[model samples]
Each structure stands twice: as structure tokens, then as C-alpha cells.
Target: MRIVPSEISSRTRSAAERSVFAALKAIPDKESVALHSVHLPAHRYKRVGEIDFVVITPELILFIEVKGGGIAFRDGKWHYGRGDGRTETRTEGPFEQASSGMHELEREFRQAVDGLRGRDAVGGYLVVTPDVDLPPMTTYEPEHYLGSTAYAGGRGLEAAIRRAANHWRGKGKNRSALPTISAQLRGDIVKAIRPEFDLVPSLHARITDLEATFERLTTEQLEKLDELEDNPRLIWTGGAGTGKTFLAAEAARRSSARGTVLFTCASHTLAAHVAGVLSADSIVVLPFDRLDEVRGRRFDHLIVDEAQDLMGFGHLEKLEELVHGGLDGGHWIFMLDRNNQVLAPAGYDPEAWKYLRDIGAMNASLRRNCRNTKQIVKQVQRYTGADLGIPMAGQGEQVVFAKVTGREDEAAQLDRHLDRLLDDGVAARDVTLVSSSGDWDNTSARLTRRFSRIDRYADTIGAGKQRNRITWASVVDFKGLENQVVCLIDLDAEDLRGRLDAVYVAWTRARAHLWIAVLPGVNHALRELGVAALAREGAAE
Candidate 1:
């Protein structure tokens, strides 16, 4: 129930004020009974300063002065810093100014407002921008004309606003003379503010059971998939976490309805993930090593996911040979990200992944990543110096780089970390712990033993269904897969150098949070690789 709409527009408000306003909109009680951006007394408004937000509730009306940027009270006066580190301009009195503004509002409303005809109470506060260090103050006050005392910034302001709303809702109100118009209040405010309010309260994209959009394709991805149907032969490429395997599954599901669809990849783990999601009888998910078994069979469409991985083991001539002899429509699609070509015992060089372009196949590249938050993508980009393009940003934790004592501590740290992520509402299935090399017992077997106790993804299909498990995967096993929270553990300078592309692939696996774990006395090279030591974590084995 919006009584007075916020009149602050981009033209009227500075960027900082716009930020504050956006934050206010994200508040749960934003649309609930409020008067905003008001300078009352009908027309003599210059005498009274603007009240940024006034939450009108049954118990109390809260008058809030919203300011963005660094607000610190130091050296006896309140100073408003522009957040540029330097340039803290002196602002006279935000608290005193809000107090006086509320006084004028109450005095004028004594007669102007029919609801508050007699004695009534109000509250005032100064809501500053996030990360602003507000000096200590009273949580509540009663001596002033209006109750003006609470000082808040960021999420604290949301709590203050909610406390006022819940306080009013609990007491219940006499709405007979309320300021809210019956039919159009919410609509009017939504229309007025939706354009200007364009931010989440927090910056990261969250991953949870309810929010599975981390794997869903953007409109751009869907358009590319739709466009691929027209072309007989196509090569689709994208960075890791850009939904290559998901697109391949989509292709298999769609093509299976008409004719046979053969879906193949480099890893059996990814093949199994694809198999679980695609139920079409006409689709067969397999590895590239089994190409000879179905040598003479004709498939209407041959969809290759993780093309670099598949092409890593096989030759271009063999791929061409399979395509030439086995297809109903002679149509094939190769979906891969070249940067994801991690080295194996016998692996193709980066040059081998480019053979498709020589064949004059229609090509399309997707840059807008469908997985990983903007922050996670930035970290991966900083490390690899690759053009992965900006992500479709979502809410999640910042990337963490930590050094531990050894394997035992790494195990303990991951155990605690997994618990914290689950408590934060990330699905257990959405959290994955990965290692660069599977051969090292300290790195792989140590963590794998502990992970074996948890409910996790099984390597075999016949193994009974498992849910709510913290998944463990080799960095290679995780190709074309993404998780909400991923810990790239047991990686040091040696591991990172041994598989530089693996680091790029592993880092991009995080849809929300990326935590890189290393051992003590082994982080100097990793630091050079752009993964700085955040804090000591693991213990000795």
C-alpha cells in the first residue's frame, strides 16, 4: 500500500541516490504502506528538506534519509565520502537534518492528515550505502519529536524497514481514514519505480534446489540452437560453463523425435549425465572410443559434445570417416570449447581442435555464459587471460583462494565448507569438490575416501539413486558440467602448470562460488598463476 510514490527519477537523483533507491525497492516491505520522496506542506516544500523514504505503518511511521557512498562520522563532524578513497566532502548533519525533517512532517500532518488527527508517533533514520562505516548510535530514541535514532547501511536497512512494517502489521490498523487509495496504490508505485530500481540487494547469483536456472539456456543460446537446425553441418563452440553439454542434450532430445540421434562425448561421466536427462528412445549416449561398435549404423544427426575431448583421442580422418559413412541426412554437429582441452596421456595439441573450420562447416560461437556468476567468470578470465565473455551474472559468494597444512586439513576444511554451503541453502548436489590429478593419493584418494561417505553421484547407472550429496569429481570428469559451489582442491603450482587448461576448466565449473585450495609451501607458483593465498585452511595428513 503506497500512499505517496517516490518521485526520484534518474534525472532527479544522482547515481548514488539511484543505487539507494534500488536497494529500497528490493526491501521486502517496499510496496507495503509507504510514503516516499516527499517534501510536504502542499507547496512550501523548500522550508522542509526531502524525506527519501517514509514507511507508513499502523504502529509507527519511519522517516528515512537515504544516502549512497562512504558515510563516516569522524573528527567531530559527519562526512560524506564519494567512495573514491579520497574526496570526502563535509556534509553538515544527516542525522539532525532527518530529525528536523520528520518534525516538520508530523507538525504539518497534525491537521493535513485526517488519520493522524491527534497524538501519533513516527521514527527517523539515515540509510547509508553499503560498506559505509556509520558511527555508533542508539538503536531507538524517544526524546526527539519523532523517534529518530537507528543508523543502518546495506542489509541492516532492510531489517530496520521490516521491523517497522511487522510492528505495524502486528498491531493492526484503522484503515477507514488511511492514506492508501483502494484500487491503484500498488500498481501506481510499481509502475513509477520498476524502471529506476534495477539491482539485487546483494551482487551474487544464488544456487539452490528451487533455483536451477544455472543450467538453463539464455535466449541467445536457444536462438543458436534453433539456428543450428537449418544448417546440415555445424561446429558450435563456447567457453566452459556456457552449456555445451546441455545444448547437446537439447539437440539429442529434439532430433530423436524425428529420427535417430547419436550423442557422444569424451568422458563417460558427462555421457551419463546426458543419459539421465535425455529419455528419448531414439537417442544413444556413448563415448568416442565406441565408434567402431556402431560402425555401419546410420544416424540422422551426430551430436558431439566436448568435441575437443573426443577429438583429443581420435583423428580428424576417423571423425571424417565416421561422418562420411554413418548418417541418414549426413548431418553432424560438434559442440566444444577449445580452452577445455585438458592434457591426457595421449592428447591432441590445441591445433588439432581447429580442424572443423577447414571443412567449411557452418560455425557459431556463444560468449554470454549461462553458468558461473559474473565474479567467478572474472576470476577465471583473470587467470587464463581468455575471452570467455561476460556471464549472465547472478548472486553468489566471491572467489576464495586458500592454502592449507596438508591433506587432513584439506579434508577438514572441505567438510566444514560443504556444511556451510548446505546451510546457506545451496543444494548438496550443487556442490562439487574437484582435483586436478586423480593419480595422487594425497590429492584425490584422501578426499575421495571422505567423499565416499557422503551421498554422491555414482559412476555407474545401476547404482541406486542418490540425492542431496556433495559430489566429488576429477577435474577431467567435470568437463561440460557445472555446480553451484565448487572447490578446486589439492591444486598447487605444479598441478596448475601441469594442466593450465584444466585450471581454466575447473574454475569455470562454479556457477556461484569458486574456492581454490592448495597446500602450504606450494602456493608460490599458484600465486603467480593469479590465485593468491587467502588464508591457511587444511591440516596435516
Candidate 2:
């Protein structure tokens, strides 16, 4: 039951003391015996220490100390500290502190009883730690200590005090006098401790100020303002590594102020991920194909993510129908990267891109790649034709280039890379493998079969889903996901004429290191794009 005095900051301690006082008032016999009292004057010689609660009956006076933390006891000492700050230094343990405090209380009780005739007196100390671990007793002790975690209910500490009170009652003490003692104890404790708890309003004010400071927009915020403002129609643009989905979700959250916000995405898996992150009571998400169904539903705002795959006049017409029909002067928000546009089935005009641009919609772009390192971003820039909007100067490391002759050489190369990264203190979650195609499922299976160390996912995995030693994904599926290091395999796909564009998307997905695996015959388009330098000597043969 011993608690760290430092762990109980003045702010929290005051609140705890108030809670104790409130709990005492609910006890049945609080008023008659003056039995409930707190912060009553100790004997003149006893040292001054603020007690959390004091309950007095005619038979007994109880002293309580409240500790709130994830309490731990190890190596014969009680440890009560928060992990958010510096590690706590253990000195005199909780047992010693509580025992000493109890000794002091006993001395004060004896002094208080000196003048009272024919009154039996008892003194006990109780320690309470709410929501913290407690150690089992190795030896018997006189002081009562209980932890909220082990106790079924929060009343563990109070129960201990009641037990001691019951013991004194058994000694022929006058039970009728309990109420007067309780009321006096409650009043005295509240008076002594009220000053400490009064600081909460000011503390809350400071926290509010901090939140306001965080909300003030910087240069990046200004660009977002312009992007959302300029594009009145369906405008879609996203930074690959940046949390585009999360930003889109948050935009939907804020858009609720203007009107009802609806979320839609091309990929069902990606849509589900976004739905999991953004689904709240207020916002709604519907499948992109379900635009017809959504047309009848009234909404104030519409947001579409992964818009690259939603090509052709039909898709655009459906969106227009939803906006014109469903919305009541609502805004439209679209999140996408145009270069990430993979093939739309035949008969679809790729010219849909030009139409959105010619419409004079707000075309805002996020320049700062907040998710990836400058080196990896630069490498991605070499493959993808994205303009480097600004120069990034930081202490982050560059992407690593590993060239192998063929797919057969990939297994050993990947194993070595994994070992080296792990040896360098890289966590498995920080690294990822990106395949060049949907065929990545087979690619990941082959790699996992050869090297059991790698972990792969078929769909896009966000920062929240990373739990394994290493995550492997296809470049297409991993579009919105990011990692500290990425190994991009099968970059030399013959079917993808603009393969460098996909490679660029894959490269930027890396925040620190990028490892690309290309076949022996490098694509000409990739060569023209300058990412062909990633191929080893004679790789294009």
C-alpha cells in the first residue's frame, strides 16, 4: 500500500483527496458520531503531512494515503513511476514509507487519546494505488496495503480501513458515536486539501492553449488551404509516402462542419483500411461503385481516395451525378496521385486526366515529402516526373541500391540485407518488400519459401498493421503505405511500358533506404527515365 510521494503530483493528489472525501460521505454512519473526518490536527509534536482521507468512529481513527500509478515492486523495493518520463529511482521502498507514516500516526493517536477517559483507541494506515500492479507480501506486516488492479472493485483500500474499524468495534467501543467522528474527519480533510485541487481549472486552461498552438497552420497548411480552395470539382492529389488516407479522412472529419461527408475509394481493401481509421459516428463511407445508391442519400460533402483507378467518362459521370444529386451545396474532396494511374480496362480514355485539369478546379499538391528521406525521395524523383517543389535538408540517410543478375539471385541478396539491417539495429517492422505487379503474391511466396525470415502482406499495410519482423507487399498494393526501408523486386516488368512511373511510386514509399531488384534485360523506358542506373552491369543484356 506504500506509494511514491513524487508520483502523486500536487494536481492529481488534490483530486484523489477529494474523491476520498466524497466516498466517505456515502457511508451510512457518517454524520452521527463525528466519525468521518480528514486532515484533523495530528498531535502537536507529530510532523505535518496531508492525509488523503481520515475516517473516525468512536472506536477507531483511520489514516489513508492514496497512490495512483502502475505500481511495481522488485528487488525488495516498491517502484511507483510513470514510463513517460525518466525512469524512477528506487530509494526507501513503499513498505518503509507506509510503516513510518503509521508509526507517526500511532504516536498522534496516543496523544489524542490521553485526555479521553474510558475510550478505546486504534490507529491504522491504508495505502491505495488505483490501476497499478501490486506485489504479493513476502512477510506479514501491520500496515494495510491494497492495489486497485488485484482488487475486483475500487473499494479495496476502503475495505481495509473498514476491516480495522470493525476490529475496534468488537472491543466494546460505542458504535453510536461513529457518525460524529466521521463527519468531523471528512470536513477537516476537505479544508486542508481543497487548496491543492483548486489548480485543475488553470491546468485545463494551459492544456487548451497548447492544443490551439498545435492547430495553427504553417506553410504546409497554407498549401492545403489553396488545394482544397482551388478545386471545387473532384480534385485528387496525394503525396505517396505522406499519410494521404489519414489526411483525407481528417478532411472528411472537418468537412462535416460544412455538410455530410461521404468517403469512397477504388480498392475495397484500401477502402476497408480507410474505413477502419476514419469510421466514426458522424462520417459515412460507401464503395465507389455504389455511387448510384449514394446518389439518393443526402450529404453535405463528398471525398474520394485512390481516384487513379476510377478513370473514364462513366466514373466521372457517376461522381457528378452524386454531387449534383446528393449534395446540398456540398464540397467535393479527392485524394490521388495521377502518375499512379495504372491501366484502365480497354475502351477507357486516359484523357480523363486532362478534363479534370482543364476545368479550372483547385489543383493543390503536397510538396514536402514528410514520410520519406530526401535521398529516397530524390531517387523516386528520377523515375517519376514529380517536381521537387522544395529542397529538403536533414540528417536522414540515403536509399541503398542492391543489384542482382536475376530473380534467382534475389533470395541470397534479400537474406544478407535482412541480416545486415537487423545487425545495424533496424527493427523488422521498419523494412518492407514491394513487388512490381499483382503477381507479387507469387513473388512474396517464392521469397518466403526461400527465406523464411521475411513477412509479406497481399494488401496495403499501414503503420498500424506492422507487427511482424518484416512486411512484404506489392508496389501497387502498397501505394499509400510507407516504411523506413523498402526492397522493390521485379522492377524490370516487360508489360509495363511506363514502368518507371510505378517504380517512382514504389521508391518514394521508402522513408530511408530503397533496394530495387531488376531482371537482366532492363526496360528501355526505365533507362530513358534514368532509374536504369539501378540495374547492375550487363543487367540489360
The most accurate candidate by TM-score is 1
Clashing pairs in 1: 204-394, 204-395, 204-396, 205-394, 205-395, 205-396, 404-538, 409-538, 409-539
Runs in model 1 with CA error above 4 Å?
1-216, 312-314, 321-329, 340-346, 349-354, 439-452, 455-464, 531-541
TM-score to true structure, per model: 0.55, 0.51
The parts of candidate 2 lying over 4 Å away from their true place are: 1-218, 222-243, 290-295, 324-329, 340-361, 391-395, 448-455, 458-466, 493-496, 523-525, 531-541
Query: lDDT tens digits, residues 222-251, model 2?
Result: 235334433445464655654456557656
lDDT of 1 by residue, 1-541 (tens): 3332222322233455555455565566533554444221132243234566655444456666656555666676767766566645455566676767767765665455444454334344444444444444663232221211333334445556656544433444653433432224333332333222211111012212133222234655655555544576778888876767766666666566457778887777677667666656777877777777777665777788877765642455455555534322367888877665432324645556555655535788877777778788777766655557657767567888776787777777777776777788877676777776653345543563455654333343225244456666777777777766788876756776655577787888887788877777556665665542122111211
- lDDT against true structure, model 1: 0.58
What TM-score would you give candidate 2 relative to the actual structure?
A: 0.51
Q: In candidate 1, how many Å is residue 201 off?
A: 28
